[model samples]
Target: MSKEQQIHGLRPIIEAIENGEEISKIYFLKEGNGVLFNELKHKAKQANIATSYVPEEKLYKLTKENHQGAVAKLSPVKFADLEIILETTDMTANPIFLLLDGITDVGNYGAIIRTAECTGVTAIVVSEKGSAPINATTVKTSAGAVFNIPICKVNHLKDAIYLMQAYDIALVGANEKASESVFESELNKPIGIIMGSEDRGINPSTLKILDQQIKLPLKGTIGSLNVSVACGAILFEAIRQRMF
Candidate 1:
């Protein structure tokens, strides 16, 4: 972890949280506890920041200086609010949104953002709890594209979907079992594309809410494509349709 990435000590961590810093997670000595530690932990929980207990050796490895038995990892970019993005969206144009469901890989997340930016996507929505942390690695992997696009973090993806639906944006998902091909799907409409994690495709419950599900036809022996690659393919299709 980089020095710029971590905030050490209880008082400093508390102040950072109070200052509205984007803290990804907090780590504290497993055995350490006191009024200050409890306060820090309480503050982190209230802020919805993940917290973990680590050994002294781990803290030492993270920083040689005094950490006061607590350290917090900061997100490189502040997360955007979904409601705010929707409120400011230009309803006149056919908006294109990308919704990531449980995608935890930072590299894939970064690459998806890069593609979304290139394709002129309106915004990328992700669940605040399950989404990957936008750290230095994600920023670097995106080739700095992470900074160019608006990424809305929502409490639940379903809520974002419902909001977009209310705005007349169709929900489209990329699924292997879908009978329809992505190329055949109507991409010119105001739509939101849903991409799932590597382990599981879209959650079964989420699939129920999709207005349409699309599949990318494959001729080779390979069964599936990486989530990032799949995202690029679908986004470019939308771009092509919108351009013509």
Candidate 2:
């Protein structure tokens, strides 16, 4: 983590939130508590910032200064508004949007962004909470491609999914148990591809709302591929379908 991308001390974090800064996540000492701490928690919750209670050692590891039981990781890039992107983008071009659900691994998130940019995805959307921080590691791993694409952080994945559907975009999900293969699915359309976390496939409730579900065929014993690899495969298939 870069020192420039961090804000230590409880008061500073509260002020940052109040100032409408793009905070990726905040961490606090699990055993620490005070009126100020409570206030900070309230502000973070109100702003929908992700928070975690960790050991005092964790706070020290984040900064050498007196962190005062709090530390915040700042997002390197400002996120785009999903509704604005939906309204302004040329939807008639058969745009492809990628929605990430519970992807916490920075490397996987970065790789997915890189793949999305390369495969001509219109934009990428992620939940404000439970998603990976767009820190230095993520930017580096994306090979600087993060700057080329618009990334939207939404309060809830379901709301964004619903908004996309309202705009006439079809929703599809990548699931191991899905009966249809990506190659056989129709991808040359305005579609949103939902990719789940590394551990869980798509959320059951989310899967229930998608227009279709597709999977990549697996011949070996390995049941599934990494989320980033699976994303590339499906997105490339979409590209191939549109081109051919």
Off by over 4 Å in 1: none
TM-score of candidate 2 relative to the true fold: 0.97
Q: Give all candidates' CA lDDT scores.
A: 0.90, 0.93
TM-score of 1: 0.94
Q: What are the TM-scores, per candidate, against the unseen true structure?
A: 0.94, 0.97
After superposition on all CA atoms, what RMSD does each candidate show versus the true structure?
1.5, 1.0
Return the clash pairs for model 1, or none: none
Off by over 4 Å in 2: none
Lowest summed lDDT across 10 adjacent residues in model 1 is found at 77-86
Q: lDDT (0-100) at residue 23 of candidate 1?
A: 91
Q: Which number leads on TM-score?
A: 2
Per-residue lDDT over 26-69 for candidate 2, one digit per residue giving the tens place of the 0 to 100 score: 99889878999999989989888899999988988899999999
